[model samples]
Structure formats: structure tokens, C-alpha cells
Target: MGQPVLLSLLVLLAVAQGVVLAYWAIRDRRFRSAHRAARHLHSADTHAGRLALVGEIAGSIAHEISQPLSAILTNADAAENLLGEPDPPLDEIRRMLADIRRDDLRANDIVRHLHSLLKRRELQTTMLDLNEVAATALSLIQPVARKRLVTVRSCLDPMLPPVRGDAIHLEQVLLNLMMNAMDAMASNTANGAAERILDVTTDRYDKYSAAITVTDTGPGIAAAYRPRIFDSFFSTKQEGMGLGLAIARTIVHAHGGKIWQEGTSAGGAAFKFTIPLQAA
Candidate 1:
């Protein structure tokens, strides 16, 4: 009787071990699959596409960085002149140094933001403030907006909740929407719409989601094209590959959010997207 019971116990242990191994194997496969999909989403093609957008504002970026550099040089020259004086104004020289340092940091930040966008990497999730993300995107695009004479406005909600997602990807989405808005208004500058305005706003869509909207004072989407606006490779621009909206939708959806366009019969286009707030 004892021997029979011991054999049964051995069989039960072996079955439990097999089940555990099977479960881990399936989990590992799922994890690899998800990782591969994410890599594909942020592939070399996506990076190239982003670089193309950067190229559009390359001159503006150069000018933005050059301004700070010019300031630093001017301050340095003034400080040198002060040193040459018999009774140099040490106080003034200190102020000049401070100005130079500030300009240096400004230039560094511009480069850092640009570099972060250009880098190719996997998605990294973190708690983020949508307001800050919008502000950063605006800072990066301000030079371009100024060059094009587009008035940019932002209304960020101070009570906005934190969201869980990749900040870089979210910024990319915001930049894409804002760029598209600017492009939409480009033709309007010559047409009836005299005021070229781009508005970005952040707020809570509901108890669980934070939303952002990018609106433009351009001619709204036609009734015919409204349905397939987010479809891949459906660009209205002659030189556009039509992936911007598609990618934006994908990224937003991946974060458990939704994106949609508001009708603008009066004259203007609004694209809004939401990201779910982090759970308690």
C-alpha cells in the first residue's frame, strides 16, 4: 500500500511541473510577439518619415539654434571689452557671464529635443503630463510657425491627470498633428481665410482619459474625404506619403485611447486624441 501511494505522488509532481513549463513557454512567446510588433511600429521607415518632417523645418531649426549662439558670442565680446577697461565693471561682467550661460543652456536644450526625436528606440512607458508634452512640441515647432506666420495658441488644463505612455511617441503625435494643421492653413493664407491660427488644448476627456486637440483655421476636410482621413497612404498632399494620421491613430490606440476629427462646416479643422489616465 505504501509503495503504490508513493508512485501516485511522483506522477502528480511530474504533471504539475509540465504544466508550469507549458505556461511559461506560451507567455514567453506572447512577450516576444508584442515586442516585435512594437519594433515594427517604430521601424526604420518610421524614423525616415520623421526625418523627412524635420527636413521641412531644417532652416528654422538652424536659425533657432544660431540665435542663442549669436547671443553667447555677443556676451563674450562685451565681457572681453569690459576686462580691457582700467576699472572693469566686475558686476556688469558677472551679468554678461550669466547671460552667456543661459544662452548656452538654451542652445543645448534645442539640440537635445531635436536629438531625442531623431533617435530610433523602443517604446518606453512612463507617467507623463500631457500639458508639458504639448509645450515641448510647441517649442520645437515655434520657429517653423513663426517662419510661416502661423499664430500658435495653447490652453493646457492645470488639473490634467497623469497618463501612462511613451513621451517621445506622444510628442511625435502632437508634432504631426500640429504640422498637419499648419500645412492645412498654408493654402488658406492666400485664400479667404486671412488669419492663420493653430490652437492646441489639453483637458480631461472623462474620468479615465486626458485629451488633446489641435485645431487650425484652414478649410475643413471635405464631406467626401472625411471617412477615410485616417487611412494609410491616403494623403491629399502631392508630396505626402499619407502616413501621419495613420501613425497617430496607431500610437493613440496603442495607449488605450481614441482619436477623431470634429466637423467644421464654419471653417477650420480639429483633431483630438485621448490617453487614458493611470490607474490608482
Candidate 2:
């Protein structure tokens, strides 16, 4: 009887020590996370300030470049017409000129995207087609998906109603979400998984709201972390700075919408956000 009682006390003490250690570890982690979030916010603020100056400078230079770019395109067209001559096989020259024009347009598109990112304009609320925004994001990420051997599909409602928001900002939100999906699946692909897919869907929830959902076939978010997924500096990716989802949540909320995780049936992660539908 005496030996059994002593053993029971030892077991209870061990359990108590484990509980104390776990509590300490959790408190330490929370403290570290708070510090990381503070640093991230500071960095993001600094980055935004620099982008504002860049936006102004870029806006100025864009005007100057357009004139020269226009002239160059005109000259290239004339050169192509001249190369149409049936002598010396200027076909190579024509093809080279075509390539140059193609690349020039690609560069212009990149400039537009950069301008959108840097512009600090106030939210310009207007009628927006969320489906169209999702389509554009899919187009942008298609290449990345292909490179990762991931299949991306969409199931957009054909008669979805328009929502009110800044089109550029909305596009940014969808793009951020889609890119996050791709990043999440990157590990699965690296491991030579058989299948990787991302699906995006949009619909009108009612007369008042429109919704979009982005789902990925990657390792799902742990239940413990889902609540803090949108919190600043809360990241699952090793290299992620964890600002993407935070910025996304800000954009959705600014548009008078709610964003949340709806853990998927596909055993992966899904995120959805909704905005107020604009009346026709």
C-alpha cells in the first residue's frame, strides 16, 4: 500500500510538470509572435512609403516613355513592310521585329501592374465584376500552375451580379489569394505528388452580397492555426512574410465584405470572401 501511494504521487508530479512546461512554451511562442508581427508591420509601412514616391516618379516617366515607344513601334512596322521585299529572305528580320514588339507590349503590361501596386489613390468604388477579376488572376497564375504541374479550374456563375469596389484592388486580392494557393501546393509538387489542383468559384449569395471561393489541393491548414491565418506575420510557409492574407483581409473588409476560411471537403484548404452587390 505504501509503495503504490508513493508511485501515484510521482505520476501526478510528472503530469503537473508537463502542464507547466506546456504553458511556458505557449507563452513564449505568443511573445515571439507578437514581436514578429510588430516588425512585419513596420517593414510594410516603410515599403508603402517608398512605393508612394516610386508611383509619382513612375507616373512622370510613363508619359515620357510612351512617345518614344510609339515611335519605335511605328518604325518597326515600316521596317516589317520593307522587309516584305521578295529578296535576301528578310523573313528572319521580320520575325525578329515581331519578337521585339511582343516583348515591348509585355514590358508595358508589367509597368501597368507595378503602377497599380504603387499607386496610393483612395479607394475608387465602382461597379466591379468579381468573376472577371478572378478570370484575370487565373490567367496570371496559369503559367505558375503549369510549372508546378498543378491544374487550375474555375466554376464561375454566368449570371453573377456586379459588386462595388476598386477593380484594381479587387484584382490584387484575388491574385494574392491565388498565389498563396500555388505556394501552398509547391511542397506537394516538389514531393512528386500525383495530383495538384486549384479551383476558384464565384456566385451571387443573394440580392445583397456576392462571393468568391478559392480552394487548393495542398496540405490543409492546421485547425489550431486557422483562427490566426489572417493575422499579421502568421505564416505556415518557411519563407513567407505572411502579409498576403492580412492585406487581402483588409481589402475585403474595406469593400464591406467578410473573408474567412471554410476548410474544404477535398481535405485541403479553402478561403472565401464576399462583397456587397451593386444595384443596377
Candidate 3:
């Protein structure tokens, strides 16, 4: 009887050990599968982002090139008319040629900028002036703001120190923030009031970092949605793919910065980010 009892206890112990081992094996497999899936999804998302940026640049180039091309055609026609006459005006022809050269240069610059922005290669980091980048971004989007009746107020601190970052990525970050703010205001304008306003400011918070704030006088984000606002595919806008803020945050983080949103004093949302100041 004693031998039978011992044998039963040993069998029970072996079965328990087998069960534990099986559980661990299953858990390990699950973790590996989850990690692989996450990486695949991230890769797909990155590819999609690059494609979308390409589309945007193509559209902008089409519009930008159209203006200069039209000007070149007009100038060419004017020059031809002058030559068709018995005596062509040499000064007018020279002026027309100068205009054509200027337009060609403008077109070349646009293409170069687009190529730099759309490059899929790694970032080239260097010391960058926040005020200059902010101004350039605002200039690019001012037309959109004006069309939506949004007023932009810039308060850039000239004394701020430069930061180390990729110029193109930094510009994209600022442009995305401004466009998001403009979109938020436009939504409000469509529903009720058209009092749209955006405030973009840059200041040095301390010796260590510089801050950039994009504030909008639109409806503030709900408390429930605030936490997930930076999450991918979690946009509040109808047409938003929910990737802009996510991509912006990633870029800021890559530059050793942090991006976040908070309530503004004027009853709206404020997106603020900070980057470490470069050693002077």
C-alpha cells in the first residue's frame, strides 16, 4: 500500500511539471508573435506615411510649377510679338529674358526643396534656428489660414538658442502643428462661429531647452480624448488619418524633444513642444 501511494504522488508531481512547462512555452510563442506583428504594422504605417508625403509634394509642385510655367509662356508670347514687328525693342526683349531666367530659377528652387523634403533617407542633423523654421512654416501655410479666416499671431523670441535637429523634419513638425490648429478652427467655424485664430510662439524656457507653442482658439479637446490624442489612428477630424500628431511626436522625440497638448488660457487647445538647446 505504501509503494502504491508513493507511485501516485510521483505521477502527480510529473504531471504538474509538464503543465507548467507547457504554459511557459505557449506564453513565449505568444510574445514572439505579438512582437513580430507589431513590427510589421509599424513598417506598413511608415511606408504609408512616406507615400502620403510624396502625394502632398507632388500636389504642391504641380501648383508651384504652373505659375512659373504660365509666366514663361506669357513672356515668350510677348517677346515673339515684339520681334514680329518691323523693329523689335531690344530692352523689352532683354527684360523678358531676365524674367524667364528668374522664373526658371524659382522653379528650380521649388523642385530642390521638394526633393529634400521627400527624400526617404536618414535625417541630417545640424544646429537649427527655431524662429527661422517657424517663420518659414507660417509663410507656407498663411494662405490656408487666410482662406479659412484664421488670424495667425507670431511671437518669436530672437534671443532663443539654436537646437540640433534635421531642418526638413523640424519644418514638417511645425507645418503639421499649424495645419492641425487651422483644421480645428475650421471645424468650429463650420459649425457655429467663424472666429478663428492661431497663435504660434517660440521662447527659451531655460538654459537647457527651447519651447514652441501652437495655440488655437477653437473648441478644446475633451478630457477623455486628451490622453489618446497622440496615438496613431485616433484623430477627431473626419478626414484625418490620425497619423499627423503621432508622426510629429516621433520626429520631436528623435530630435531629443517632447511634444504635448494642454488647455490654453483663451479656451482652446495648445500644442507645445521642447527641444534641447545646442551648446553655444
Candidate 4:
């Protein structure tokens, strides 16, 4: 009886081990799939693509690093001048110190965001509100548009369904498109189009997907360039290195979405990207 009981116990142990191994294999497979998608995004195979990505990464590093460093230097200069005063106001110095800290934190955030943006990471999806992401992007762009003397308006559907995507990356994608729209408008200086209106909207594209559109009051992409606008190293702007649209396309594709452009009724450019909505 004792021998029989021991054999049964051993068999049960083997079954448990098989279950554990099977579970890990399934999880690893999923991870590998996601990792492969991430790898394709950053992988530079073609010569032209690599060159464009390198230039983009360099310029982005410079832009991200310089802003906060400039702010820190400006604050330091102000603090130094304040220190030279016979009656140095502690309150003022304290404010400067706080600002320096804030800017330093901002620089750190930029570094982190860029790292996440460029690094190969698995796409972690969650049910995310598209309107909220659009709203946040608009709030951030409003100040930038104001500085450029452009107006940004939004008409987001409050009842829009949630999509499965990484929220941070979605926001980045939205901002990228809006920035392109703004740049398109900025280039309109030659066209004498004074009305620079950037209209952003979100609505249901279909029963299974939702769309976000950014329309700009500027000359739309030429027929020739429209085909290659999202291609690597394709740029309309003189200073553009042409990585933004490529990156945007990759992100949207990875999320099982599609992005495209067209000429809007307002005689300007419009870009619309759609993502699959999560099932109820």
C-alpha cells in the first residue's frame, strides 16, 4: 500500500511540473511576439532608414537636452545676479532654486520619454480613452500654437469607445501628428493664408474602430509627396529630417491601426489615424 501511494504522488508531481512549463511557454511566446514588433520599430536595416533615424535621434537628443539646460542656465544667471544684491531676497532665491529643480526634473522626464520612445519595448496595451489623450495633446499644443500665432480647436466625442493601446505612446503619436499639422500651417507664410486653424477631432470610424483627425489650414501635401510622406527620409520642410511620420506610422501599425492623409474641405491638409476599439 505504501509503495502504491508513493508512485501516485510522483505522478502528480510530474503533472504539476508539466502545467508550470506549459504556462511559461505560452507567456514567453506572447512576449516574443510583442518584442518582435518592438524590434522592427527600432531596427535599421536599410541604409536610408538608418541614416534618417540617426539624424533624428541626434537632433532629438540635442533638442531634448538643450531645453532644460538652457532653462537651468537662465535660472542660475538670475540667481547669481540676485546674490550680488546687497539685500539678497531669500524668497526670490528660493523661487529660482525651485524653478531650477523643476527644470532639472523636466530634463529627466524628457530623457526618460525619449528612451521609451526609441527603445525596444513590448507593447503593453490597456483600454484607453482616445478623447482624453486628444485633450491632453491639445492642452499641450495650445501654448505652442499661440506662440506660432495659430489657433488649435478640438471637437472630441465624449462617448467615444476606449481603444487598446499604450496611453503614453498614443499621446506621443497624437502630438506628433498635431505638430506636423502646425508645421504645415507655419509653412503657409508663402501662401498668405493668415487663418491658421488646427482642428483636431475624434469619432467612431466603424463599429470596431475609432478615428482621430488633425486638419490644418495650410497647403496640403502635393500629390507626389502624399504617397511618400510617411516613408522614411521623406520631408516637405526644409529643416525636417523626416522621421516623425515614419515613427508615427510604426506606432499606429503596431497598435493594429491605420494612418493616412488627405486634402481637407478647408483647402488644407488633414491626417487621420484610427485604432481598433476594445470590445465591450
Specify the highest-TM-score model's number: 1
State residue 78's C-alpha deviation in candidate 2, in Å.
12
CA-lDDT, candidates in order: 0.88, 0.75, 0.80, 0.78
TM-score of model number 3: 0.73
Q: Per-residue lDDT of 251-279 in model 2, one digit per residue for the tens?
A: 78878999998777777888899999888
Task: Please give me the total number of clashing residue pairs in predicted model 1.
Answer: 0
Candidate 4 pairs with clashing backbones: none
Tens-place lDDT per residue, model 1, 86-136, is 999999999999999999999999899888888886567899888889999
Q: What residue runs in model 4 are displaced by over 4 Å at the alpha carbon?
A: 1-121, 189-193
Flag clash pairs in model 2: none
Residue lDDT tens for model 3, 1-280: 6999999999999999999999999999999999888756644554456456546446545776788889999999999999999989999999999999999887777666667656654556888998988886776566557666788899999989889887777777887888788778766755455468899999996778999999998888899999999998899988789998898887788778999999976778999999889983
C-alpha lDDT (0 to 100) for residue 76 of candidate 2:
76
* lDDT agreement of model 2 with the native: 0.75
Q: What C-alpha lDDT does candidate 3 achieve relative to the native structure?
A: 0.80
